[model samples]
Target chain A: MTTVMVVDDHPMWREAVERDLAARGFEVVATAGDAGSAVRRALAVRPDVVVMDLQLGTGSGVDATRDVVAALPGTRVLVLSASAEQADVLEAVKAGASGYLVKSAGADELADAVTRTAAGDAVFSAGLAGLLLGEYRRLQAGPDPGAPQLTERETEVLKLVSRGLSAKAIAERLVLSHRTVENHVQNTLRKLQLHNRVELTRYAIEHGLTDPDSA
Target chain B: MAGELRQRDLLAPLWRVVVAFRLVAWVLAVAGWFRERDDYPGTAAPVAVLVAMAVWTAVVTVAYSRAAGRRTRVTLLDLGVTVLVLAATVATQPAGAFGEGAPIVTSIWVAGPALAMALARGRDGGVAGAVVVWAAVTFLRGYVGDREVFNLTLLVLTAGLLGYAATITRRAELALREAAAAQAAAQERERLGRAVHDGVLQVLAAVRRRGVDPELTRLAAEQEVALRGLLTTGPEVAVGTADLGTALRLLATPDVDVAGPAEPVELPAHTAAELTAAVREALANTAEHAAGAHAWVSLEPADDEVVVVVRDDGPGIPDGRLPAAAGEGHHGVRSSICGRLADLGGSAVLHTAPGQGTEWELTIPRGTPR
Candidate 1:
């Protein structure tokens, strides 16, 4: 089971998240009330996923995420907030959060989110994910000498993946064998020289080749 | 200080009257001395009379120059000239002329100086000036004539009393105007504050939270910025004078048909802001609960007041539902429409029953200026 942690100032909201994560079969290792305590708990537990609220009682969630991410590189942060405020979204991402979720989301979506986040699959609300990907795409489009470019097949694969297609489905649609589809994906990874699938996904996103919602 | 003196713009006519009156008074007084020179027999007496008239003319011109001039320096100059004119006239007419040893006309010139300071510098300046003149002239009156001391003292008392009274009346009028201005400012602030609270601020705060529409959020931000801009532009926001009908139509145009007189219904800034805010709140409620049905508006302008009515054809508001709506923080109707208009010396009428449509009427006295 993936280890999880939750941090929030409100007791009710904190308990609700703990209950949701527990029901999803993830082991909730700890909870915290403030940014300092969140960082300390995150370091101590080294949970695979840390679900944190943006607004804390005594400190900022962004700062807490930065500290936790620095000390425990294995841990991913999922930001939960009542606000979809643009400043909060941008600031949380800058401070190293992997995902941003608004609390208006239902319980099942939150549970699914924590599960997906622990597996290293990025998650965001529908519109907000587009905003983040758009920003990354804009930054990548800026003049850069060392930026990598994808071949026609790799670009097509990335677009399919962004459209929420699996490899089996992609093979059927591209009229290639499943094995051939896998080889193209592998070649794409090796040529792009990325270590993992997550980096490939991020690259697809940052180049505007894929819509995050498709994932 | 400059704000108080903007009334100098209004005093231009009074300045003209003072100058024209002074010129005529001086010319006639000068002509009288020349025509009656034979009556004096002694050229010295006639020359003294002319010199006295010339000094009076100079002092009156100085008073005119300062129509809104400095109080202290002008008063002192007037006193010096009056003393010189009176003393020179006494030396020439030592026995008597017009049964007077001195022109005592010098005292009459004192009125012109007092009036000049009063109208130009206002009451306090005039009062302070009139008191000094009265004191010095009372001393001069005691010695102005050898035998007419008692009579001259009485004249000094009457002259001082009259000038002082004019000073007090001017002060009272100024105080009334100041009070009116402060009231207008306070009422305008209350109107704008209610507008932001009802329409813009609450939307922004909600958008900051979840469960809010992004389109509404952007609109709220735009409106907040618009309201702030209006404040910096000052209270002269008279794009049009709004009677009850026009005001309602302005609030609900295109989507709502507003009916009323086309005649200009002049409203002070405060009244217009409050009415517009009330209309906005009512329409926002319609949009939220009325399911996008068209609203109808009407204005009724009375001699001293205006009434604005905005009605919507939709799911009618339920009976005895205002209290529940207020409890649910649907404050657009309660605070924005009803309570807001009331603060501006107006009343709001909410007409509805279940499935009968909702009609809102706001009555504001035209004279309230709020």
Candidate 2:
């Protein structure tokens, strides 16, 4: 049986989780409450998986997981907490936690997370995957060129297009001639290698240059 | 207690009004005394009138001070003193002193206080207090001096009318407060609903609807659910960043009950973000290790420090033996929760036992906002 460790402070909650895990065919190796003890237990038991609460009375699970994963080497940690803050999800991944799951998850998901963690598969919440991926892409992309090589006028024209403003409206707002605004739009499309306003909107949104509310 | 204190603050200005009334009355009475001496030189009636005015001024002052029974027993003492002064003045001056004017003046004093007290207690006792004071004033004014009982009665009736007006003001105040509180509460509910609608609930519904990802759709759905849970709720939530409690509650799921205070507690946005990430890592550990075991997560105030605690009844950790726990991992507790807290000048505490369970507490002081 795969050995798993549980860390939490509430007795009833701990029991319910343990029972669920046991039923799911995982052997419970150990449990811990605080960060120090959690580290010690995770190291000692060398459980295949560790389910940790992001919040602990005396310690935090993220720190505990770091220690556990560090010492045990192979132990995978699946973080469980009531919050779904994006930073926490991203941080847990940073801390060597294999998965980040909110407490509102069902018993099945909890059990599944342990299995997935043990399988060495990356686990994250839905919808937020885009955010994580986007962040990852940003990091990979490094500091973008000081300027996207687009002129200030180009940026303004793109913003207007994303906002659904007609060339006439953009011209009026910017106090430029209508033909001048259209020229700027054509220039922006060429610079960004975009064909139409739709593609222009997507690019602006991806770069966070456009408001989602506007889109 | 805070509500009561706030109410007291609201009533404080009323006392100032009372003080102003008394001061002016005293001044007028002294002025009237001087006028009588100038107009009716050597006349006993003028002297009587001046004395009466002086005594009435003192009585009204006493009545105002004595009205705040919700405050202390000294008010009763003041009342007794006022009544004595009124009695002395009535015996020497006009018979109308105790006959009718007394009750009306008492009513005036009671009206302000009754309304104030009612706001704190949320009961009709405030109105009752006003009525009792009004009646007492009327009775005292009616039976006192010989200034024609009918005229005294009319004075008492006029005071009652004023008292009624005061009561209306109080009622208006109460209605306004209630309306404001209700508006706030409704706005809060709407905000939370929106968060769910836009974030958590929507994610859940979407996951259910769009579970047909060509690759890892289920995981995508699950991730969306997590993201949704992370979003803040409540109307105030929209105007600014989420409070610690709201963030915790939104992140709450099957593993634990995460809750924080309702009032918005601001933390350094960057620090908050770091700590939030730490919490997420810890929560993931609970889900994987605990295997659906119950858990609790809490954020509390601890003597100039904010403490986050997560607990569960699971097997305990043996003493020492942390050598392997500190290994390098792209995803590990050290980098996830501890490192994040450490970055914020906060430390995490973990306690465990074989049969007992595990409790983790993270204490972050207010000042250390890196």
Candidate 3:
């Protein structure tokens, strides 16, 4: 069984999601209501998948996602949030979240997302694909020479994904194997997360937050 | 009344400086009177005048400190007392004093009323008060000599500059207050939005997910989209342009899904309107012909143009159906969707086949001809 953890501020939502995952045959290892407790519980439980909500009572799911991903490399995060919280969703993805789904998704869709996330596959919703396309465009507009760029094939795959096409459909259209299409989608997110990490390190070093001896 | 109090508070610092000037000038006047005491035929009247000036200075200082006391009537009374003190100079000085160019009994203390008027009313009031003082001095001396000319010029310039400074300070204060008010309103709106998202929107989502009744689910979903749009977008853009992404997002319903970039896709106002109208027509066509069909509208922005793809998973159009419809004078798709794009210096392509579904790709270039 795939071990799962749920983090949300609403008690009702936490229970509903827990019930849904339980019915779907996933082990509900733990749950948390805020960022601090979410991080601590995830560290203790070491679940294979963490379903995160963007809005916490007094803390952010993005910070929790960063801490959990840093502490356990084997775990993956899937954001379950409202469509209006697009900016926060993007930040969570950069903080090492693997997938995003709207809160109104049916139980079957949620189960499928969690299963795929546990299997180490990138789950690209049409909205996340759109955000990634816009992010790459914005970065290319900047003056940085070492900024990340997407291959032509990756851009083509992302455009299809943004148009609400499934991975199987994209594979059939592009004349590639299903695994290759999934890899392309995963590469786009990996590049974004890598770039964010490099930028943060550069910022810390420039501001003298990093000691010279450590460097 | 509140506005009057705020105005007084804004000008309080300038008024303080004016009162300090009056006290320093009064001290100098008293010193001059002591030095010329023996020159006067009788010292009794000079002593009385000096005492009156001292008492009046204290009275006006206390009055100007309060908002109710800083009125036009009080300012006029202050000028009247100043003129009276200037007139006393002629009575207290000897005849030889005028010919010998000795200083007047009021000395520089006469400028106090002009300074007060400048801070109270601004440049015009300052100039008017200075002219009244000049007239009194000229009448008392019976001449406008070099000394009188010099004193009048100094009084007018100083009063005018102080008045200008006070006016600038008051305007700055009003601007700062307006800016702070706008910031506070924005923060309040954001707080309310967060509260609504935490409670109302969450419940709505949960209701839609329950799917107990199709009609209830539709209504709840529609309200959720509307509320989310209201919280996210700002006031509508200006007349010349609009965000196409925002316009298209409004078309989203339970069965219709809209996807676009997080950033705004801006286009000319009329262009965006026509494109939105075209998309609406396309969705309407789907609803009419393909019952139970789910539609997706995706916006893709490129460096040179924007492409909107509207696709529906439904029974596809039969071969040659479009040509036969055009022959039968059915012009819904041709005129509504394709014609709109044609006018925008773009093209619309429709692809369909048996069981393959229908898709319309509409492209509008950024540099379209007016």
TM per candidate: 0.32, 0.33, 0.66
Candidate 3 per-residue C-alpha lDDT over B68-128 given as tens digits, one digit per residue, 9 for 90 to 100: 7877678889999989877876777777566566557777888888888887788877888
lDDT of 2 by residue, B149-205 (tens): 553454445434444554566666666776777688777856775555444543443
The worst-scoring run of ten residues by lDDT in candidate 2 chain B lies at B100-109
Q: What clash pairs does model 1 have?
A: B66-B69, B244-B299, B245-B298, B245-B299, B271-B370, B305-B366
> A194 in model 1: Cα distance from truth in Å?
13
**lDDT, candidate 3, A64-142, per-residue tens:** 9999998999999999986766678889999999999877677898999999999998778887898898888878988
lDDT computed for candidate 3: 0.85
- What residue runs in model 2 are displaced by over 4 Å at the alpha carbon? A1-3, A10-29, A45-48, A54-58, A69-74, A82-96, A102-104, A119-121, A126-215, B1-59, B66-370
Could you give me the TM-score of model 2 versus the true structure? 0.33
DockQ for the candidates, in order: 0.01, 0.04, 0.35
In the range B1-370, model 1's lDDT, one tens digit per residue, is 5755655444545544545654665566556556655555466665665566666666566655553443456655655665565455555444545353334333344444444445445555455555555555555444445444554454445445545555565566666766777678878976886575455544543442332676664454344334433332122223334333233333422234443432345686567767877878787788888876766555545567676667777888877788897899877678888788889988998878887678787888767443
Off by over 4 Å in 1: A133-215, B1-370
| Model 3 residue B34 distance off true place after TM-score fit, in angstroms | 55
Each candidate's number of clashing pairs is: 6, 116, 0
Q: How many angstroms is residue B43 displaced in model 2 relative to the true structure, after the best TM-score fit?
A: 7.7
Off by over 4 Å in 3: A212-215, B1-192, B234-239, B323-330, B368-370
